[model samples]
Target: MDREFRYTQKDFNRARAFLLQLTGIKLADSKDSLVYSRLVPRLRKLQLEDVRRYVDYLEQHPEEEEHFINALTTNLTSFFREPHHFDILSEFIQRGEVVNRVWCAASSTGEEPYSIAMTLVNVAGGFASSAQVIASDIDSNVLRHASDGIYPLEKVNPLNNKKLFFKRGVGVNAGKARVCAQLRKLLEFQKINLLDEEYPVKAGLDVIFCRNVMIYFDKDTQEKILLKLLSKLRTGGLYIAGHSENFSHFSHLMKPIGRTAYIKL
Candidate 1:
């Protein structure tokens, strides 16, 4: 059957408001096209007339909020994506710095955290036995997938020489790979909303990979989250963000190294 399409302005407004209220992710008027495009499949699957009905159903059923959040949040990521950051991390580990604990604060679908795990395994050459990876995401659905340590084979394509970090599977799981048991053993996945007033973990981390998450928040919100993240980072530890993000305004708390990496001074 052909999918029906009907997205009115009122529907767009309702979805935008509902999403912002629930997740603090602001979807602007200009994003109407994007909103419609992303949610249309959901509407078709649910057999809803348009976006407004979908919003109403979501509001009435609080349990489905997670589904809405997962549908809307962009979780694009890759292993070793910005390889230079891992290079820096390997160098820091080579210097024998205290880095037993690392947090991938915005580890979407496990890529970033898994990438970190692979890097540790390579540099430490079995030294990761003493290390741990805390990988958190706001979306619980994605967190579940991350915890499973499974990914489509294509996602591991960017690992370069790090293919040994994963184990291939076939049959029902064909075209997929799971993080090596050793790497999976070191990773712990949790659901954490970055906008929360207090984060759960109090351990002072030696490094944090919060890349690509702050680009969605406003400047003040970005600073607030960054401050909270910095509080958990040990002195002289590092923080990395998306390549497009800048820390010129935060120079007082963090010193910019090269690229988008920062050191907490």
Candidate 2:
């Protein structure tokens, strides 16, 4: 098959290796097409000859690394995705747990963390709750977008307290809504590379929602990140994993409490 730009096995291998080294994310052999589709735009933007040139440009121009990672990293998310997790959180709060400090480890476009803030607010009956949510991601671009707290109506409409939590846009801004100041205030966004030597987040968090992120890593990288994340979560605190992410292998560190959710031991 002919593509607009030159893409070879070597290019894919080099790019995937760099990505793994920089982010602890492993790309499978089947991801060549995926890589091409995700990266062609970057090549066009940089006016590069091919994927090989893009890889060389990445190494030569360190500033290009961010754009490269942003291009490849998946940011598929929706407001209140996996509603059951929020239900579990409500139950935890009702059961007399004071969940004050929470972390959303991969807060793609801010939906997950914002959903968390909404849940905490609902449980506490207002914005006066002591809960604070720290939302972080590896992509700087997505972090900025998440910090804005603006989304299309399609994403914002289904939220039960949409009116209370978000303000509708009108005129040129129609069909969009921005999270209310009260809702936005509950969260702080930061750029965090899971592969970092030391996680900059504070220790002793009450809950951690690191869902769906471990799937990108290999076994050893996953275990390394999980251990670091667990150190930040207090014992008996809730640690939520993605639906497909099973932590049963780490039973000694955490125990499954609900669907793909864990309790730090």
Candidate 3:
């Protein structure tokens, strides 16, 4: 097949290996096309001739790592992507488990964390409660998008009770909506790379919403990150995982509550 710039298997391997070293994420051989697509823009920006040159440039300029990660990281999510998780969170709060603070480990463009904030507000029967959502992602680009709190209208409209949490856009901003002030105020976005030895979050969080992101990591890396995440949760605090990810093998550390939701032991 013809392409815009020279790309080869070795180039893909080196790029993916560097990605794994920086982010603890694994890309399969099937991801070759994806690697090509993501890196092509970088090649153009740097006036490079091929993927190999981009890889070498990355090696020499450590600061380029941020743009490299931002370009490749996927942030496909929506409000209440897995609706059941929010129900579980509501239940966790209702049971008086002290859900005054929560963490969204992969907040991706804001939907999940905003959903979290909405749930907390609804559970409290209003916005009067003192609760906060610590939203984080390794991808700085998505973090900025999340912080801006603007999204297409179609994405916001399908959500139940959206009027309570979102403001429809107008004029030049039509066909989009912004998360309401109440919901936006409850969140604090941060850039956090899961591969780091120590996270900056406080210990004893009330709930952690670290969903599908773990699927990108190998088993050992998954386990290592899970333990570090659990250490942040208070005993009996809620831990929610994506439907595609399961932690039943680690039952000794968590009690299965509902679906992929767990109560940290």
Candidate 4:
């Protein structure tokens, strides 16, 4: 088996089809280089000679599915990446609403959910104690990192309440920060593929943060995922989306309340 595997169009198509089937993420033809870069490492690790062999291995070994998904999925995220949504959340909390359960649907590397947790802790007033957030993503590797709750110091330095939600490392551990125990207690990290017919989360969610993820899917897949997410959202509950997303198709079910934020009517 050669380590320098040449990924052909056929190889790219096969891998793309399998990924789309499993995760509903339609890889564009232009992603040929990106696919090659991500999957070649997998080929080497699995002792396979080429992309075709790797695809065959994927079909034969269902258990390798998680590794395959972990390899291809993108997990770009940051704390409070969209600050406006958090502002809306703060206002929602202040309104004395019944917001007990929150869901960070694409909780890549834990930033979005942690930001949600910080908002609840800081702005939810007394209601923060009873609230819980479920943070999930398709990538098992990123889920592990999210659970660890450690980030570089610079990531949290901009946050106003950095000292409250994160513990700044000292002595030998300087220049690093870890999520404090109080904030970590409010979040649960799990592996969830939105392509699934149904999620394991409890219904009546108060807030759903399905951010910066749907942009990877086509229209049909996006609509299906939105419908499922809406079913889990309780009446008057909020749904936060990435700034670039447009849920105009589901306007009958939800009304826009703010920039990329919606409320179930």
Q: Which candidate is the best by lDDT?
A: 3
Candidate number with greatest TM-score: 3
TM-score of each: 0.91, 0.97, 0.98, 0.95
The positional error of residue 130 in candidate 2, measured at the CA in angstroms, is 2.8
Steric overlap count per candidate: 0, 0, 0, 0
Superposed by TM-score, candidate 1 places the C-alpha of residue 263 at a distance from the truth, in angstroms, of 1.2
lDDT of 3 by residue, 70-119 (tens): 98898999888899999999888787777888999988999999989998
Model 1 CA deviation exceeding 4 Å by range: 1-5, 44-47, 157-163
lDDT (C-alpha, whole model) for all candidates: 0.83, 0.92, 0.92, 0.89
Q: Write the per-residue lDDT of candidate 2 for residues 1-265, one digit (tens) a residue.
A: 7899999999999999999988888999999999999999999999999999999999999899999899889898877788999999999889988899999999999999999999999999998986799999999989999999889999988779889999999999899999999889899988999899799888999999999889999988898899999999999899998988888999998988899888899
Candidate rank order under lDDT: 3, 2, 4, 1
Score candidate 2 by TM-score against the native: 0.97
* Model 3, residue pairs in steric clash: none
Residue-by-residue lDDT tens digits, candidate 1, 1-265: 2335777888888888787777667776788788878887778788888677888899898986887888889888887888899998888888888778899987888888888888887887774357888999988878988888888888765566546677887899998988877789888887888888898986589999998888887788888889999999999998888888898788998998879998899
Which has the better lDDT: candidate 1, or candidate 2? 2
Between candidates 1 and 3, name the one with more favorable TM-score.
3
TM-score, candidate 1, is 0.91
Q: In model 2, what is the error at residue 87, expressed in angstroms?
A: 1.1
Better of 2 and 3 by lDDT: 3
